[model samples]
Target chain A: AQSVTQPDIHITVSEGASLELRCNYSYGATPYLFWYVQSPGQGLQLLLKYFSGDTLVQGIKGFEAEFKRSQSSFNLRKPSVHWSDAAEYFCAVGAQDYGQNFVFGPGTRLSVLP
Target chain B: DAMVIQNPRYQVTQFGKPVTLSCSQTLNHNVMYWYQQKSSQAPKLLFHYYDKDFNNEADTPDNFQSRRPNTSFCFLDIRSPGLGDAAMYLCATDQGGGNQPQHFGDGTRLSIL
Candidate 1:
């Protein structure tokens, strides 16, 4: 079974500071990676996704993720985070098969100190 | 325009009483999914419907049931609400699989009393 691991359970950063969230996955075949952000009392919004080709994928809200095949990692990064960026971020992996089963990580809570 | 809609953003039900949460999609996606998310935990997939075919997760409790009457609507039914079932129920739709980003509704926050 494919699984995703997010090492940090909670992280706090000051506003205007750079941020990086770590994510690692374990899958047999080439993996499809995705990042989702969930705000308080709201549904999840897609941040970015890496299916194939380029290792670096850009997403909405000035967020980006890089797919590292060797490290089995797809980390989300933002040059500068705003107060609104504070939310729960999840990393997920999808199977290459037809079923396209997607497994989610435990998620990391990001806190921005203004 | 909101692509996905989940009714009764907050619901309170007595224990052992059956409650239904509705989700409707305007995207006309082929796959619709129900996910249960508790505080400080990942969202767990309860079940999904691909067209008319139903796929329930292996560990999903029989107490929780789902119905997809057509392409536009899906419902989650809790036969017996328990304290453990008090959580946010999220409804999402996708074209086929994870390759496409799944659109999500605001979700229904279920409370068991």
Candidate 2:
């Protein structure tokens, strides 16, 4: 079975500070990794995804994630986070086939200080 | 622009009453899914439709049913609203293929009275 784990439940960071959210997955084969952000009373927005090739992938809103196959980790990072960046982040793992359902992490709540 | 839309951003219903939530997509994706999310919890997949074919999760309750009348619309019906069913219901759509991302709607918050 495939599963995603987000180690941090909640994180507080000051504005303009760097942010990193950790995500780890357990899968038998190479996995499709994704990061999504959700604001209060809103749906999830795709931040970035990794299918194959490049270990590092850039996403919208100046977010980026590096896929480390050996460590089974895909961590999201932002060089400078703004107050608006405060939201819940989820990491999901999916099979290579689209028909397969995705397993999502519990999510990390980000709180940005002004 | 292509997008997924879910109706009734907030709904309040009496316990044991039947309620239906609707979802429509302009993306024309082949797959539409329903997910239930409790406060501060991850979204849980209840069922999905792949081009009119309904697929239910193994643990989904018998009271939960889904209907995809066509490619663009899907409906989730709760036969009896329970207090435990009070949560945010999210609708998502995706083009079925390798590595395709799913688009989500703002979700409908269901409150049982």
Candidate 3:
């Protein structure tokens, strides 16, 4: 079985500061990874996904993540955080085949301080 | 825009009462999933419908049932609500294939009293 671990439960950063959220996964093979963001009282929105291509995948809202096979990590990063970027972020891993469900992390809550 | 739609943004039901949540997708994806997300927790998959075939999670309680009459619509039915069942129920849709992104609706917040 595959699982995801997000070490940080909550993080606070100042506006305009660079931010990185760590994500680690345990999968037997190369896994499909994704980043999702959810605001309070809102459903999750996909940030980006990694299948099989460039290790660095760019997502909506100026977010990006790099798939590092050696470390089994796909950390989400943003160059400059905005106040609107405060939300909960989740890291998920999916199998390469069909009919399989994605395993999601517990999620990291981000707070942007001005 | 074509998207997944979940009805009743908020629901309040009494304990032991039966409740049903509806989800419809304009994207017409072949797969629809129901997930339960409690406060400060990740969304846990309850079940999913692939086309018309239903797939329930191994640990999903029997009280939770689902119906998918067609590809575009799915329903999550709880036979008897408990306090533990009070959580946000999210509906998502995805193409029934590898590497496809799942789209989610805003979700229905269920409150069991």
Best by DockQ: 3
Where does model 1 sit among the CAPRI classes?
Answer: medium
Residue A63 in candidate 2, Cα distance off native in Å: 0.3
Candidate 1 per-residue lDDT over residues A4-67, each given as its tens digit: 9999999999999999999999999888889999999899889999999999999999999999
List DockQ for all candidates. Answer: 0.68, 0.74, 0.77
TM, every model: 0.98, 0.98, 0.98
**i-RMSD values for every candidate model:** 1.4, 1.3, 1.1
The TM-score, computed over Cα atoms with residue i paired to residue i, of candidate 2 is: 0.98
Could you tell me the lDDT of residue B96 within candidate 2? 75
lDDT of 2 at A62: 100
Candidate 2 deviates by what RMSD? Answer: 0.9
What is the DockQ ranking, best to worst? 3, 2, 1
Identify the CAPRI category of the predicted complex in candidate 2. Answer: medium
